[model samples]
Target: MADQSSEEAARLHKFVDPVSYLSAFVSNGVRPDGRSCSTARNVTLNIGSISTANGSAMVKLGQTCVLAAVKMELSNPPLECPSRGYLVCNIDQSSSSLSEALSGPPTSEAQSLSQTLQDLLSRFVDCDDLILVESKLCWTVYVDVVCLCNSGNVWDACVLASTVALINTQVPAVNTDVELPLVSISSRRSLKLGTVPLAATFTIFKDKYCLLDPSREEELICDGTVSVIYFEDGGIAQITHAGKPLSSERLISMCKDGQTHTQTLYKLLNTVCT
Candidate 1:
């Protein structure tokens, strides 16, 4: 029985190696998925997908899938930001994605991805817009993202989910009774948001190829990555580069491409949600 187990393990190792090498080779200039480095895999988003949450969205980027839910509750505004409400983001990676050999809490990879999404979202939100009252009470919005599947490019998937969830969210207006000095809570309404933000990530390989929205296999062979978040009006919200410094020319090209991509995504979201 032990011998049989050993043989199976060896076969598994053998199967994984050639696939890894082939993925690396493809990263140089070709993708097994046959997508150009600058092209994104097909994206599909479903808004109000979760019935329990106030607002929810499911985003699928290729095989990667993520669900984001937005919940709002009434709370006193913080002293520092008295006029603005608070936004909290939490991300969790499901254990099912990990191999049997890797058992533990979220790995560094997961934590970094979570932080990236948090920061990217922060850049687009105008916190002051969420304030309903001066210092007494305000809406606290909580966004939670769960990785339902790992098809690679979790950052992009999470960002897509977050964006759609925010758009779908409706903050209930506070209701007050006539006799209580407007102290009682009653009903709810949707918050007015000015503009939405979108993010696009590119993976650099062989110091030449810049693949947009890399899958799991392409990510392994890539030299580094860059994620750019853009707001409407052609303004950049955030830019993150990891691994090495990219040339200014490449950065410019990415910004140009990101603008076009952001516009495309924005239209898609509006069409689906409406």
Candidate 2:
């Protein structure tokens, strides 16, 4: 009876004031999900999981799961820049992943996320590598990401899955002798890619405590969130903030943490992706 009463009181506190409720846990040096303030959730990576796609990968960051697939299509290069090709990105959120059922087009948030991801990926991809025949036909690389779960930190998960999928992707051999290009489905070669880029997200509570890799519930109660994109070499690609402003010192500290997190992810990729 005593334990039940305690649980009831906890629920009441959470409903009345979420920030204070979360603060109670943080003051105790632990989060509701049993993780330290600085500790991130476990990450799982898999490559070439989808046989039908040219290349595919799946990433799991705790309960949040994302799948990414790459498809190659042939198209004419733009007249202005005939030497370059294209790298397109799209993101889809599954109905089961959200609180409500999705019946129509993607939500505005999903579209915004897709556009942001595309812009970030464009910085890494070299369209020159996509050219099959210069000034003629080129490969349009389509990268599709599907959110199977939205437990939290989805941006990082999407980036991880997309990067691995691109690494696993292969281009089919093309026969240019004929009027129409003949693609050999069985004959394929992998694209050239350099260092992979990844993202790390942090949630700030009450403008004081910074939590790494926040869960869905934590995100709801967060005062602000920061996302940092970086490469394996500790070079930052981008930093974005939402909700509240942060001090320069705090931003720099988060960047350092993001760099460290990227290095850890790179090592894990090497071990699991082969």
Candidate 3:
């Protein structure tokens, strides 16, 4: 009898107005996944999973998962920035993760997501640290990430994966001589990373509820999403959003909420490092 009732309710929630159904659940401080309104899904972080890459990490938040790998190569510095090397971040979402799969070329949404991640992450990484030699040769750190799943809170998952991967990365020593520089794979040196960067995503549903680390069902029915990126220096580096506009008061509260999570992430990373 209990199973039958539960199944019927689920069928009603699926076919009926999902927004209203979810709203009712939220107001009661319960979600379909059995978590409280403000609680986030489970997060699992694993590092150095890809042996071939210089560094690699994978982060799973509920059903959403992202894998990040770092590769370093010798390259000349840009003309304008002669002293610094490159810190590039490239992101790709698998077609299997899409709800309605598209044929032909890659979707514009995926391209836009990659560009957004690149812009936001560029500010947090210390590109100058990659410079082995001033102008002759430097390390180009390529951060390639692939989304294995996309249940929700993708931005936060990517941030977690990238940060962990960078922490695990090691650059080989370079020999600057003759015509060109040569890399000594035998002599690898770890990157000198400062405080790791962190991010938290807040979602607003309808015009009322503000959810933290929303799930796919909540994200789909939400009005907008605001992601706040926290820097090592105890300041927000970037705040980007999509969908409807959020109020100033709400945004401030969201930042505060995000800061708390940033602290938690730092603690988790510290454990990994040790």
Query: lDDT (CA) for every model shown?
Result: 0.77, 0.89, 0.82
**How many residue pairs collide in each prediction?**
8, 0, 0
Better of 1 and 3 by lDDT: 3
lDDT for each residue of candidate 2 in 1-274, tens digit (9 for 90 to 100): 9999999999999899888888999998899888988778999999999999999999999999999999999999988889999989999987888886385899887898899999988877788888878889999999999999999988899999999998888899999889999999989988777668899999998898888889988998888999998888888877889978899998888887777777889999888778
Sliding window of 10 residues with minimal summed lDDT for model 3: 97-106
**Superposed Cα deviation of residue 261, candidate 1 (Å):** 3.0
State candidate 1's TM-score.
Answer: 0.81
Give the best candidate by TM-score. Answer: 2
What TM-score does prediction 2 earn? 0.94
Could you tell me every candidate's TM-score relative to the true structure?
Answer: 0.81, 0.94, 0.91
Q: Whole-model lDDT for model 2 versus the true structure?
A: 0.89
Question: Model 3 scores what on Cα lDDT?
Answer: 0.82
RMSD of 1: 5.4
Q: Compare the candidates by lDDT and give the number of the best one.
A: 2
Ranked candidates (lDDT, high to low): 2, 3, 1
